[model samples]
Target: MRDILVFLIVFGSIPYILRNPVVGALMWVWISVMSPHTQGWGFATTFPFAYIIAVCTLASLVFTRQPRNLPTAAPVLALLAFTVWMNVTFPFSLYPEYAFPQYTRVMKIMLMTFVVAMVIKSKEDVRRLVWVLVISLGFYGVKGGIFTLRSGGGQRVWGPGATFIGDNNALALALIMVIPLMYYLQQTSTNKWVRRGLTASILLSALAALGSYSRGGLLAIVAMCGFMWLKSRKKLMVGSVLAAVGPALLLFMPQEWASRMDTIDNYQADASAMGRINAWYMAWNLARDRIFGGGFEIYEPATFAAYAPVPNDVHAAHSIYFQVLGEHGFGGLALYLLVGITTWRTAAWIVKNAPKAPGMQWAVEMATMMQTSLMGFAVGGSFLSLTYFDVPYYLMCALVATRVLVQANLPPPAPTMTRPG
Candidate 1:
């Protein structure tokens, strides 16, 4: 029954995806983010639903009337550069079989991101995309939050297996990023009940992050809070809400959680932290030595012997910076960094310029929220090598799409002048 239902939901949308590629994009995002098929005993487990959706959606785009709003700009070009570089580095991969499969998956995500930038034309489309993302990802956050309250944050909150957010740390990072999107939706929503629900969702998602017992999540949350408070239109109200919920959450966690969190201060003494540091150094040293680096699955014991400080510890490149550097060399890392930093600056520019224009107020709100999400990723990702993840790039694509609409339809605000001191 579950399999049948999932099949209907996934396959039923194919026709609509052909009619409107944007809807198809939303469905793809929903499945990728939510992994609804992975929830339980369902035929979706074996069914190639995602591949089918991708094929149908792209085929649909070729036949349907496209909005042609796709920006032929720097972000897209950077993405293409990064994608090409990945393929270039793949032949040098230490484990070609492992690297090729992962390469295909990431390439698909990149292609879909470009598709989204093409199909989504207006602010409302962006809003709806955010809604779908929040609902898909927030479902787990809210559910995990309630479970934390009931379990006292003793048991860790994990994600659906075989997905990007399969581990506690990964799930926590994802939840942290989506919280800002949830807030964006809440701010734009006119329905009072929706506002209330989103408020609860934010608190719940935070709790879920805490429940994951992820040190990186905790750090990211702190950074996120500082920005959230500063970026908010109403600082006082946001502060008050944080003040109310923060203490309660801390008190809810068990002594085990507390002791685990205390390890953050003494990271050098912690085996896991030390292992990550060693991996970072290995990636850095190896990238400096090899022009194309070691490529995927480069963290073997022998590779460590060549470059790692310890020369014995075999560890994954747990930091995003190291992950890209090790996998694709300096050229790939440079391209990746340029894309992210440029997207962030673009978002900031949008936030500054979109407010005065009523038609593009949603862009202002979204760009502001995008900054918070980027903050979470930039901070949390330092401790984890999720360089190939989709969420951040998707946010960047949203910013690109929004910038096109806001820039064309609305004029820039007059620059303010200050008196000489």
Candidate 2:
């Protein structure tokens, strides 16, 4: 019964965990887990997954058999507290409705960061969690891919009413960031069948990413692959040739894909793309004009009115840097960059030291993936507010925390003492 309960908690909740309130509740209690800020259609606009995670986090604190790992959690907690304080005291005004939702969004991210740090302690724990995420998302990807191919492939379907849903893009990014782990597992797994299965899963994920039709997602995959190539130049050159030729020979792609490629260049002439440029300029102007900001929600409508003749309001700058600049000015943007840089440096250190420990091979792989994901977001953020998604941000924090824990568990360097005769 206990095993059954655990299985149900982990597996049964995957589909609805991000959007449903009931499953989300289960997730918080070690019964389940999900990304709170996934872009999808569901029962709620923002999804109740974060609240569920918070609940489960509290439950873990109260009832888990293992003692709380405060050392691993301290940095995460401090960061969360600071973010909340900054949000509340930043002296920016926003529409009450918008501000309230934004507050919850920030809180959700903080909760995930805290829970992942506390919950994932060992190498095995990290592997298990990664597999769970991959399996759940892989199932969806396969299904979506089949449907897309059969129906002559158009916009991807999420749940009901999920128009413009970017969950597919989100899932793609998550899978790509785990590529190093997939490679490591393939190399290290004792079970041949398991290795084969993981390889198939990786391929399916890559295809699904292509099917999502998100230029940003494609850019991320390219950047990640480029990083891998840079890490191994000889292999990269051989692999690049094979990759370039393989797709042409194997697949007959739709014309829509060609159109999508054309759209990338459309930024030069397209009105919508031009509007983003205008928005950036307007954001800079607003930052200079206001002491703190013109107010959080005010920029979108105002900028649209000022720049676009059509009066199309924008809720966000669609770029994290511009959003920060518009909402919190130079000071807030500085702090945000500081947090991101600190997290990246910490993850890099783990990767640098990974070759020393046998068990750290997986950590090194995960760290590389994390770094790639960070770079993707850093670049993608120039054009989109990718930070609004919780999964990547929380995963980055988890990696940092995991690295710290791994280092702590390492035996102390031989103590040196000098005795005077």
Candidate 3:
């Protein structure tokens, strides 16, 4: 029955998608990110629903008469440049067979980002996309948080298989990134019950991240909240509440969790930490010697032997910074970093220049939460390999789109971030 239902939804949406490409794009996101079929105990688990939808959506785009509305923003330009660089490095890739498939996957994600940038033309479109995105990831956040509460954080919180947040560390980072989006939903919701539900979801998501026992996640939440307050117009109030809530959540976690995070202070003794450092060095050396880096599956013993001092101790590039550096080289890493930095500054500009009137409140709040989410991703991502994850890229699409929506009613671009007077 579950399989039938998912199949029906995917099949049913094709005509609508052909009629309205934007709807098709949204449906694609729902299937890709949330992966509802993965939850069911049926044939839907094996169904290639996203593939079918993508085919239909592309057909719709090509055959339909709808105008393609890609926005020109710094973030979007950086993304395009980065995508071009990835393509340029493909032939140079040491492991072309392995790298090409991963390249195709990233290409699909980039396609969706452009589809979103072109399709989402209004503030309401941005809001709806936010809702779908939040629901896609927040479902995991809410479930993980409840699991933590029920099990007393005894076990780890994992994500659906073959998905972005498949492991505990990735799950934690994904949940932390969703925290601000959850807050944005709560703030914009006028319904008391809806707001209350969002509040519970936020708490659960935080608990779930804690339950994942990811030390990087612990650091991320701190940096996320700090940025949340720092960027807010009402920083003092948010800071006070954060200060009170931080300790309470810490005290609620199990002793084992605390012990695990404590290894951050004694990283020299932690095997995992030392391995990550070794991998970082290996990536650095590979990029130094080979401009395009090793491409996909660069952690093999042969590649490591060429660049690593401790070749036998090779591990995957655990850090996003190193992940791109090793897979695509310094040029690729620079383009990747520019996308994030531009998105961050673009979000800042939106927040500052958003209209002062009541009708534009959504734009202000949207920009704030995006900045907070980027803060979580930027800081925590240093320790994780989610450089090509669609979540941040999707969120960046929304931010650039939001800037367009907001700027329609405003005079000009806001001044860049300024130091204290």
lDDT by residue for model 2 (200-269), tens:
6666556666666666666777787677656543676738754974374226346786577567767777
Pick by TM-score: 1 or 3, better one: 1
lDDT of 3: 0.86
lDDT of each: 0.87, 0.57, 0.86
lDDT of 1 at 67: 69
Scored by lDDT, model 1 comes in at 0.87
Per-residue lDDT of 140 in model 2: 50
How many residue pairs clash per model?
1, 3, 0
Quote the positional error of residue 234 for candidate 2 in Å: 7.9
lDDT of 1 by residue, 114-143 (tens): 888788777778778888889988999999
RMSD of each: 3.5, 5.8, 4.3
Top candidate when judged by TM-score against the true structure: 1
lDDT of 2: 0.57
Residue 201 lDDT in candidate 3 = 89
Can you give the lDDT of residue 273 in candidate 2? 62
